[model samples]
Target chain A: MAEVNNVVEALKFMALGMGVVFLFLYILVVLVKVQAALIAKYFPENTPKIPTTPVGNTVEDENRRVAAIIAAVSEFRKNKS
Target chain B: MKLKQIFISLLFAMIALTSMSQATGQDATAPVVAEVSTEKKAYEPKTIAELATSFWQTTGINAIFDVNDGETTSEPKGHAYEREMTWFESSLGRIMMILIVFLLFYLAIAKNFEPLLLIPIAFGGLLANIPLAGMGGEHGMLGIIYNMGIANEFFPLLIFMGVGAMTDFGPLLANPKTALLGGAAQFGIFGSLVGAVMIGFDLQSASAISIIGGADGPTSIFIANRLAPDMLGAIAVAAYSYMALVPVIQPPIMRALTSKAERVIVMKTTRQVHRLEKLIFPIVVLVLSILVLPESTPLIGAFAFGNFAKESGVVDRLSDTMQNALINIVTIFLGLGVGSKLAADKFLVLETMGIMIIGLIAFSAGTAAGVIMAKIMNRFSKEPINPLIGAAGVSAVPMSARVVSKVGSEEKPGNVLLMHAMGPNVAGVIGSAVAAGVLLSIFK
Candidate 1:
């Protein structure tokens, strides 16, 4: 009976140890968060400006135009040569 | 005219000499031919007497007579040869099973059922199933690769390093309270342990069984390999399958536990993390985790080391090697090795089904626990908290975060929970690793 009780106590301690370790990790994360918040507040950098126009369409259009222009220029050079 | 005639005649003589030489060479190489005076005929047995005396009698009494001859005959070939060929006799069955695996791969890759991992996994499966390809056989290429990594637990740990390199711990550090949810979510790990033990699995088998709840493949494989290498195939398949099915498995439980309003609650944007804080974070976590749970040091240590390399900014070469070259090489070996485990004899069993079913149970329980813990925390907390982010507590990394975002946006489109969800998302990685360590220490 004493041996059984000892085993149970050991398991409990094990669980408790895990819980304590988890609590410590949680505290560390909170400390990092608080520190980051303070630093950000102290040094306020410019927010990235968002362009109003949609992204993929404009990029695709630019690429197409550039390709056409390069083709025309190459043809002109070929004719001259 | 006389000279032209002489040249033509010389050409003719040259052609005749060449033809004669070629004929002689062909005759020398030809098989010895014998002429028969009469054509040989097959013996036609019109009666029992004729059949009994025929050359067919050489096959023994079984081949001596037809059924119409009124004689019971025994087969000349023994049963041993038939028994030996029984495994190949079911060619259709083997082909069908291979087709099923191929279809699953197709669904996984083409239909985007975890394409990043499954595409390569599916290709590996197809390669292994090729008849006599010997990918799964002893001395085979895939067999050698599998033995080199999967059996030794090298591939999975290397994968963890790559995962560590890719992960940005900034979100996790930006909102620490989410770590509680990560811890709470690990109830599934214990739940699985109890369930497995109840089913008569030993401590080591139970440990492998329970890691399915971690909802992370490398962690599951690592723990499984350490605790119970015999159960590696089942545990790995369960882990990868459930990971692919996360979007399907998690939503219902997420909906059941939290109200629509709770899901829609917007979390505050995380503040910018400092460079110094980012640099010190992995070191602090590693040291603390090791001090508390020394058993978890291997996984936690490797993870922290990889992250340290990434965050330090000075070890760009080491980080790059871990992220690209090492990871790519490991992925190929791991996929083929894992596929090699899917051999017909070992994989085709009821235990495989049990592993998959229990894996789903573990995932659901983890998700539910995280949500409930979040709601409980929300009751006491001053700041607004989104319970949906709790679902990201599983260590599926960006996928779990993406699921939270998708679900949260469905309730409130403008509510961006991805960054906030990332806190618990990363924390879940640590939580599972810790749980894996606990299991390893207790079992090993």
Candidate 2:
């Protein structure tokens, strides 16, 4: 009976220890969730959606026209000279 | 004779032309200069008026002036009630300190220095420090919240329930032996307890002191609330500051104790844990703990209830609620309540500094104890467990686990100890609570 009591006492001590540890753990997870929720609620989503696929030739074509204009101006200037 | 006559005529024509040109030039220039000067002078008053208007619009100080007449008329009624802050004497110092605390909280939250609690805590600190806001003063919102929750010890427990819901026992269950490492890590708590008593703190104060070793904030608050409610402010600040500094605290102790070879020691990956095993684990652990320590029931019971909610699978909605909405609501109140404790008179003291120092000591001791225990376990065990995982035995959770992984990888490239260390890391949470329960029962 004494041995059984000692075992019971030991068990009780273990349980107490486990309980305190778990309690802290429980609070921590709750705190994290709270933070995450706050972030999700307040942070605005404003990312611009860009369609994928290259648009390359248009810029080159514009650049060629500008170059042509510049060349024509220079040619006209030379002819005047 | 003809050349002389032409020269004389040319000189007269030149003189006339020069006089006429001068008169016309002066007439044209004077009007242009006069017009420019007139336009510039006109703009000066308009710009000044615009500046005044913008100043009024931007600051809205005019609104205060507009209401000033009414406020003056009603002033006599609120004169005694409107407790004036000692703004002239303490404003500068208070504002600077508040800014520093705000930055610390921001770093802790925004940069992920324990983001779980720090962000709310930082917000609370900011709210409290606003001059004459009355949030930390008599009849203030924060003051009321603090009295209702922290001083009364309600918020900490509610937070614990949320924590329990979010935590998974799978890692700890798969490796039950790691629980012993968790137990060993708690030496810091007892060591700090002894240190606190030696430093002239009473038993209750010492219990609050020891809890800092766990590197767990809510547990510290829980113990401090019961043990030394007066010291709650100091104990909490110390507990949280140390928790944020865990990455810095654990690595040195780990390096000092273990060799490069030992640090690099890698254990095999954990086996897939069965769901049935996971479900039963919390029950068995809780039952064993409850039977052993009735005093621990509050902490243990709440934790078990949360885990039960998780594992039962039927109460998914309830678990989700606890982990999400319920916890978030409690956190705002808890943070505000806790921040209310940082009143100028209560928080700025010699005792607060002592708590901070003792907190660091407790954390260092906890890390050392964990490493030593793992070394001892390594001697007896055939499984060849890496001692680095032992450092995670402090209840800092993923931070402690990440530290172990970082240090382990530093020793050997591609060595991943994070998942393995998580076993002990999670167990450390359970271990710290058990230790807290023991102290509560013994001291209560």
Candidate 3:
């Protein structure tokens, strides 16, 4: 009878302890999920903004560069003469 | 003629008075002088031979030999074995303990079994049993260290702080359900508590001894110091020993609990945890711990504080200090402090035997419980949870996690479970702390 009582007592404590741990962990799970959801909804990940125009050399840019170089060279020759 | 006669008379009178005064003084000193002379005659000065005998006694050589300073300085009847019989009487137990400490040294050095702790503990044990060394007694160095660290729970908490700084809780955060495995594994603690109580230990002692199942050495030391200080050495040894043996102990039980299919069930890789989530996790745990079990706040709070420091990105220096310098310093002292308790008289007791047996049971039960719980969880869950990862819930940290991975990889060569096992591995840490808190609350 005494041994049985000790076992019963142990079981009671075990149940309460395990229950409390489960309850606390379950709450943690819920809060973590909610936090993830809320953060995902309100503060989405920031994607880097990409420019639409081509970054490589284009025909217009090449023509402008040639024009500027020719005008500077002719001006320099006129000043020298 | 008159002057000469007066002078002669005065001289005669002076000589008589001097003589009378001398006689009176001698009468007063006679008794005292006689007593002094009698005492002096009674005490004879020791000769060179007698002096040698006294020196041998001081050097403890008298234990094996007897010396005499008689007329011829003859040898006494005392033989090597007969003189210090008491000293040699229990040489067997002491020698055995010394051998045991040497074995501990071998385990630590060759096998690399928790060397950080075992080395100092083994050395301390060696120093403790030296005949007449008094290292484990009051006023001794080891004794002072024990009083400072282990006796008051200072060293263990500091170690916890360091452990917290080193731990990355992102794994547990990534998969919250694995936290239940940590909780489930604590069954080993409570179950063993019952076993201990049934074995005739008191409730408090049973609680302390059973916590060895939790597989956290500092927590074991902390709880033992609080509830059953007398059993601290045994419980600590058992806890760390089992933790070191996790690779050996957990696998067999883990293999038995789950089938090969369950073992190879591939768990999805956990999502990346945000820095914000990592920062908030410790604070939330600290607050919730206080609310649930205030008794556990010291341990949980220190651990959480360490984790927050590490994750906050502002105190990198402090975090580094906690992880390396501070933790290393505390570990040395904590190891020595625990070793001080391994005195022959204190450690070689009936309770020590019970603690060893119960400790193994607690660890095995914990591993079994964790794996069994994972199997049950898999029954309802859509995601197939690998049962091997569940054994990591015994809280041996990365060691248990590694074991889980190794065992799983054995079944399916490409199936790696290390990352998945880490989830329950970290959870087991928190779960053990919570379980310790529960025990402390009930006992307190």
Candidate 4:
């Protein structure tokens, strides 16, 4: 009788435990979504916008930089034993 | 006058030495021992041979050979602790425990298995088995450590604070639905509890033992110390060992549960969380927990405080200290404190075997549940959720999260589920704490 009671009680405990966890986290999930929406509405971030378009000289400068890196690598490789 | 003064000083010093020598006899003045004949029924050893014999009595080697602790009849003797003579309390048992400690050392050092904790715990076990050392006895060094933080449940709570301070809830907040996986994983705890109960352990011991499935060490220790302190040693060892072996234990189970197609599914990257949202999260969690279950406050409160401190940005110093210095210091004591419980009489029992076997069952069940939960979520949701990430819901923290990512990558090269998995991993921490709270409220 006691062993049966033990199993039954354990099942009840398991249900309560699993139920509470799911309830708590599920609420948090909804709350999180709500919190996200509310924050988006009120406390919007001041994101500094970057200029997407490259300047005219950047392409030529990039070429020069790549050439300099190549020259430096060749020089270092040539110096190596 | 100078010679008279010097003679007087010498006479005073001689008198003091004679009295001191009578008590300790280290000074070896034979006349004092003879003069105090009536007082000295227990004569101090005078000869070198006698001294050696007395010294041997105090040594570990002699303690091993002594039958004073009543090894036979399973008789309760000498503070109700003794070697079983056949099992772990025997001299052979002590040596075996030492060798086991050596294996722990090898695992920690060579195999890189949770070295920060295992090293201290292994060392404490070493100190414990050293006969006559009494390292695990009342007022002994390890005993003091055990009583100081572990016994009162301070160390695990403080560790929770450190874990909280370091936790980033951004991923969890980004994809909140994954929290269900965390909750589902806790089935491991409940499932194991039932198994333990069925196997003749009482409710409290079963509850404490089952908590190891949560795969959160501090939470396991907190619950075990509270519910079933007698089983603390075995439960803790099982908790830590399985946690360290997360990679080894979790992967095969994960593979068995999920199809290759499910493993290869890619998850959406998490959205950026606002600083305000981050700051409010811990507060919301704390308030909700306090309202619902006051029992979980010790674990959750510390965790919430840690997360709040980190999010506040104003309390960087406090947060940094909690994360680094405070946590490091607590880890050392906590490791030793847990290790103090690894005394042979406590650890090498039938219950330890029971705890280990059931602990594995709990852990496997949790992993399978998490994966299955993820599959269920996929059926209901528009976005494809990789079932592999569900296995991380046991909250071994970054370890289980990393395992998910590794497993996912195995299915599809360059696949990343780490951030996605973190959602459930973090939730598992909360989920386990909630389960712990429920258990405490009922069984405590």
Q: DockQ scores for all the models shown? A: 0.10, 0.05, 0.13, 0.27
lDDT of 2 by residue, B1-444 (tens): 989967865554454345445546767654211111213343434343334333332222222222221211111113453333333213443555577677867777666776666767767666665543456644677767776777766777777777777776655654556666776788778777666666656556767877989877778888988888767767877788778878887888999999887886756444434455556556665776766667766766777788778778888889888878888888888777776556544566567777887788889988998898888888899777789888999988668988998898789765667666777787787777778778887766
Task: Give the worst 10-residue stretch by lDDT in candidate 3 chain B.
Answer: B69-78
- Better-scoring candidate (lDDT), 2 or 4: 4
Error of 3 at B186 (Å): 0.5
Could you give candidate 1's per-residue lDDT for residues B1-444 as a string of tens digits? 999977865554455445545546667765322121236778444443323233222322211122122211111122222211124212332454467577768768677877666656656655554543345554666667776887677788888888777677767775678887887777777666656655556555766877898898888988887887756767877888788888888888899999987887755545445666677778877887767778887777778888888888898889888877898888877877776555443455566666777777788888888889889988889777889888988888878888987898789765567777777888888898888877766655
lDDT of each: 0.68, 0.66, 0.76, 0.81
Residue A67 CA error for candidate 2 (Å)? 60
TM-score for chain A as predicted in candidate 3: 0.51
lDDT of 1 at B81: 20
* TM-score (all chains, Cα) for each model: 0.71, 0.67, 0.78, 0.83
Candidate 3 stretches greater than 4 Å from native: A1-4, A46-81, B1-90
| Tens-digit per-residue lDDT, B317-427, candidate 3 | 998898889999988888877876666656777799999999999999999999999999899897779988879888887799889988987997656677678778888
Taking all chains together, the TM-score of candidate 2 against the true structure is 0.67
lDDT of 4 by residue, B1-444 (tens): 999977865554455445445546554544322221225476554664434444444545545755354333111123465334443475666777789899999989999988888998888888877775667765678888887888889999999998898888877887889989999999999999999999988888899999998998999999998898878877887888889999999999999988888887766545556778889999989988998899999999999999899889899889889988999999998888777767666677789889999999999999999999999999899888999889989988878988998888788775667778888999999999999999999975
Off by over 4 Å in 2: A1-81, B1-93, B109-111
Q: Name the lDDT value of residue A38 in candidate 1.
A: 68
- Tens-digit lDDT track of model 3 for A1-81: 776777777777788778877787777778777776665566667322222232146674454334434533453353222
Error of 1 at A72 (Å): 41
Supply fnat for every model shown.
0.19, 0.11, 0.33, 0.63
DockQ of prediction 2: 0.05
TM-score of chain A of 2: 0.42
Off by over 4 Å in 1: A1-21, A30-81, B1-97, B127-133
What lDDT tens digits, residue by residue, belong to model 1 across residues A44-72? 46223222332258675455444434533
Interface RMSD, prediction 3: 14.7
Error of 2 at B322 (Å): 2.0
